[model samples]
Target: MCHDWGESGDGAVVVLEGEVGWLSCSLFSHPSVYNYTSALSTGLNLFWYRLPAGHDLEQPIGYSQRLSKERERLWLQPATAEDTGQYICMLSNKSSCTKISMRLEVLARDQVVRGCEPAVAVAPSQVIAPLQEGMTLDCPDLQDVVKMADSSPSVTWYHRCQKFPTWGSDREQRGLSLQIHVMLTTYDGSYYCTVHYQRRGRELQYSRSINVTAVYPSSLPKHPSILQPTQDHIFKVEQGCTQVRLECRGHFPYLAGDWDIWWTVDGKKVEELNNSRFFQNNRQVKYDYGDRTVESVLLIQNLQAKDLNREYNCSVRNQRGFDTHRAHLEQEVPLPSVELGCGLGVTLLLMLVLFVVYHVFWLELLLLYRSWFGTDERHTDDKEFDVYISYARNSEEEQFVLTTLRRVLENELGYSVCIFDRDSLPGGTITDETLTFVARSRRLLVVVSPGYASQGSQALLELKAGIDGMARGGHLRVILVQYRPVRRQGWVRELRRARVALALVRWQGDKSRELTSRFWKRLRVELPVRRVSGVEGGGGGGEEGGSEGEVALRRLHSQNSTSSQTGLITNTVKEPQKVISIAAYL
Candidate 1:
């Protein structure tokens, strides 16, 4: 037989080789070569043949036929030296002939008795595919083993040391190939393919191991969602130097490099805000279920009013899907600084005005205060006399106060007057009489003359009594009548102190009508109004004395008579001589 070979008419070729332990061959028929032939239109009439070493060249040797269903492949069991020969495949038609051939050289039985190493080369040593994709593991070069042995080997596949089932059509182990319709994580592990054959009537087995690593990409359980700050997703902050935080989260199956979380403001990335007042924080949490969560936070510090109503977006993404949430920042209303300043200014101004009024117009203020809050009318009614007269102890000063002021104020002004000298009982203590009269009178009229201060303790006693009475509830008021322009040097310590608070009057004297003078007006203001009775006598005066010398003599007589009538005299005097004498001087 010819060992050299050539390409067939269709440019198809067959290469077959057999070593001491393996046999393999590949026969390829060019479909275009039979395109026009009717007899072999289907190109299905291919056949396999062998010519033994001693057989006739024209005869075909056929025993234990082994060929692929398409007649495109042929294998044989392990062969001895007797089975070494040429193997051929023929494509025939009525008009043409195509032949593919290979020669097998088998070793002696002793050489074939050697141990079976892994004769099959399974590609690849490792198989990796994503889940849900199809994959195929092939035991290549098995045909070479078949060519040496002259028998096709049976291929079986095992997964994780368990024999893989071929019950489902989707899973198959054909010849030296195992096919899986779809890959799954459950199918990940070691896979072994065992090739069982007979060589020289001896059963032999060989196997190739491979690892199938199925990659299962993580998937999102649900869409991403925002997990915090439930209120309308609006955060309220003060205008100045404020901080706000927002969080976005989502759930996904735990898959490395499969999920991403980030924050954005107004469609701008958070990192882009590094130069601005915004900051970012990120976190991820895993759960017991093959699920996990990713959280993204945005922090805004020193927030401004312009930031109000600005939208912030938090986004979470994965292979399954992506989610985004929106939140708005709002500013709270603040009190205006101008209004606060105005309120403080008004309060201070009012306080200053009150202080000025208290210092400058104190007397007037006191009078006004008394009118509103002083003792009622009942207090005034308790006073027995409207005026208490304190005069100098000297006879001339006494005579002037008794004749002029007492006569004018009591008779003309309809006032009840208490004249200490006249009202005091003989042999009574003067101090007791002074205090008693001062207490009973509503107004104390002091005759402030140069001689009054020279009277020693008598003047002191009278002034002290009046001051004491005024101090007790202020029911009694004091009037200082400057009868004669007394010098400041002559002023007693008590009088100087009391003068600031007392009512002072400068007598214009008989030079003008005393009733119409400012002195009388001011004096009457300090004294309460006098009450009138129906039985009161009309104003009276005696007929002018016969002469100045005669009036002087009668005044002495009238003074003696006034002193003799001490206990509450209703009328001054009924005798013409006394009334006429006293009225003449007035």
Candidate 2:
């Protein structure tokens, strides 16, 4: 006799023949139902009955007649040949009703001996083993049972009597092994393997079970971490220093041989306790929380200038990953000295002040020096004419030379002016007259113009005489007055030679009063000091003073009324020509 079980509408059923079995009539409740009275009210009620062979209706049976004293189990006595019939179990509640029936055919003992026995036997084995969390668990091999079958069998795996769905289909027979790839503590239980086979037009099933226990390791280490030098991680070292010390630390779980720590300068690696300029010392520490920390001290000895601005890397590595911290060793910058800065500021200020003064009052300063040291009684007695004027042969230029310049020098400025056309004796040798006048004059004023450059002969004669007088070391000074713009291309050799020796004053038109004042002042500075002679003004004096000279000049001017009136004189020895009247004043 075979027994089977199935679930009905709010209950479960169990059918058996000629054997003892328990029937649970309580309906399975959903986990969400919290009230006990509500669950009990909806539970299944049990009923039992019997059906005679070939009968369609069931005969009601009482629990006291066929059930054991427990009333939850039904017991059938031995010698079941008289009990060949159908047994039915019914279960009902307010929400559902269900029943199950099983037929029993009781044959004689000799007839049961003639039937075939079961061809499959489930193996019995027990396993008590400890597995890690990540390890795999395999079921017992079924190759022997599979070999006995004609074809490959179907296999199902269960954990704790429930279906195991981690592996893709539980029914697998090709390999005859079930695997739990990654085991956990929840997987620690009895695992069942059921094999199904077909033999002689009959289906056969067998089962095997094993127990597993999962165990965890004592400690698991994470990746190492560096935890020292919290603020910016920058190291300052002076150039040419003796040594620099740096510290690096890391934290990790207390697992031996799982972490490595070191240091690197730039990109090259440095080791601990090495025989080099850069070396380190390492130590390991443990905490109560099972964490191991490692620290390394780097010693860079005999630091040089080249070590400045270099990066030092501290790296830690373990099974998980690595970490690096960088520190820079730089030279310290020094502040500037106050004394040096003050000295530089003073020097610049003085230079600027001197430049302004020189730009504003240079002429006044020169005049002051000349007034202090320029006059000498010994040289004043030897000088004759105060100034000699030279110009081109053109009548207009001659008139200007005789009238404008001569009037300013002799009349207004009290200087005796000499010109070749006026001061020289008519019919005299020109070269001799030129040299004589240039020698007698204290200053040779050459009035230069485009017309003057064309009169090569007269300009050269005057320039050469003046240059020779200057070379002779007399009180002869040459001054160039640029009356008009003149090109140097037509300049005579003598004029070119005197260019560097002579001082030039350009004549802007008299429209600007400031310019005219500046012009007169510059020209007067070049002239010699005025000397008073007893013969010229009835004053007898070997030493000249400023007051005496002014009086003598005023008296001499009163005597030369004709020359002062006309500012010119006609050459009396030959054809009439305009000339500067210098002899009357001299």
Pick by lDDT: which candidate is best?
1
What shift in Å separates residue 8 of candidate 2 from its native position after superposition?
74
True-vs-predicted CA distance for residue 455, candidate 1, Å = 6.0
Q: Candidate 1 regions off by >4 Å?
A: 1-379, 531-586
lDDT of 1 by residue, 1-586 (tens): 2222342333222221232233222335344443324424565365566776676663554545332322254544333455566666666645555665666554433432323322333234766655676778875456655664547778878765457683355667654688778766677766766667776676765556677766544332444444554434776666564687776665655444567778777788877765567887777765533356666677877766677756677777766677666777776678798999999899999999999987876655654555455553334477767788887766677767767777666545556677765665654545555678888888888989887744344566768778877787887788898888888878888888899988788777675345655666556556654322211333222211123454344345446635644432323232234334323322
lDDT of the candidates, in the order given: 0.60, 0.59
Candidate 2 has its poorest 10 consecutive residues by lDDT at 577-586
Residue 376 of model 2 has an lDDT of 46
Q: What is the TM-score of each candidate against the true structure?
A: 0.29, 0.35
lDDT string, candidate 2, 1-586, tens digits: 2222443343322222332223332222333622334534668555666777677778986544334323322343221455665666655566565565654454444443212321112223554332332433344545544544557777777664456464444223235565444444566656666667654454555545565644333345467788985534877776456899999888765443567888888777774435488877989865533366788898988876767666688888977778888887766665565977998999999999999987887776666676677674235567667788888867677766765786556545556667766555555555566778888777889988877744335555777677778887755788998888778886666777777767888777674124236676677677775422322343332123336666566446435533632333343334222112222111
C-alpha RMSD by candidate, in order:
25.7, 25.0
Cα RMSD, model 2? 25.0
lDDT of 1 at 554: 32
